[model samples]
Target: MYIPSPFRDDDLENMRATIRCARLANLITATSGGPLATPLPLLLDESEGEHGTLYGHLAKRNPQWRIATIGDAMAIFTGPEAYVTPSWYSSKRQAEHVVPTWNYIAVHAHGPIEFFDDPDRLLEIVTRLTNIHETSRATPWAVSDAPVDFIAAQLREIVGVRIPITRVESKRKMSQNRPMPDRIGVATGLAASKLARDQEVAPLILVQD
Candidate 1:
């Protein structure tokens, strides 16, 4: 991720928040054949390593794990984003110098990836994934809700993935490069948008650091 100085986000806590909030992520690996990517839900363990550890799984038949990887894997998590038009900038009215851009948050976690077939670890990953997404429900479901045999059968069809994050890169591009008036204009424009993501990005544009 090419992040300018103004947009660079070095805060580890903020990056963790983005990771936790992201509904899904793309796990990418470089293989001899090419690159293989899997979209999945991941659980982050902040206490695992210097950075963090990510847990997820892929279908047993998925070739990504069977094939040898060339280097460390990368997990990409994206947060709320919106399109910013030059029309939203007050400076554009005076000089028309501003162009359109995107305001968004992105995080990349890179580390060595290990794939395992251990049923115990697989069960743990899926159970935690389930609980995280189901906690808001009136009646949350659990892995114990299913018959042991059924879950055991299901677990056999997947391979567990673990990545102890070695490094991380992130950017929070919310018009921090813009002047106050231009940023306010961006906030007002985004706040007026009907898109939910745009609304979510509005306040971030004008955040004071």
Candidate 2:
């Protein structure tokens, strides 16, 4: 990820928050055939490594897991994002030099990826993933709710994924490069937007203030 100095975010805790809040991620690998990518939900274990570890699963038949990767895999987690029009910038009226841009938060985790077929590990991963997403519901479902045999059978059709993160890159482009007046304009404009994502991004734009 090419991040300008003003947009660069090196805070580890902030990166972790972004990862946890992201509903899904894009896992990319460079294979001998070509580049392959899969969109999946991955959980981060911050206590596991110097950086962190990622856990997820892929369908057994997904060729991405079977193919060998050329280098370390990358997991991309994107948080709230919104389109910013120049009309929202005060500079547009003063200098008429402002152009449209985007405001977003993204974290890229790179590490060696290992694929395993161990049933025990797969069960643990699935259980934790399920709980993370379901615990907020009134009737939270759990892996134990299903029959052992049924769960075991389902696990056979999937492959477990583990990535010991070697590095992380985070970027938060919330108009930090713009002046205060322009940023305030952007925040108010986004807060007025009907899009949920835009509304979510509105407060982030003001965090620097």
Among these predictions, the greatest lDDT belongs to 2
Residue range 1-209, candidate 1, lDDT tens digits:
89889999999999999999999999999988899999999999888998989999999999899999898999999999999998989998789677899999999999999999999999999999999999999999999999999999999999999999999999999999888999999999999999998999999987747
Candidate 2 per-residue C-alpha lDDT over 38-123 given as tens digits, one digit per residue, 9 for 90 to 100:
99999999899998899999999999999999999999999999999999888788687778999999999999999999999999
For each candidate, the alpha-carbon lDDT, in order, equals 0.94, 0.95
Clashes of 1: 0
Report model 2's TM-score to 2 decimal places. 0.98
RMSD of 1: 0.8
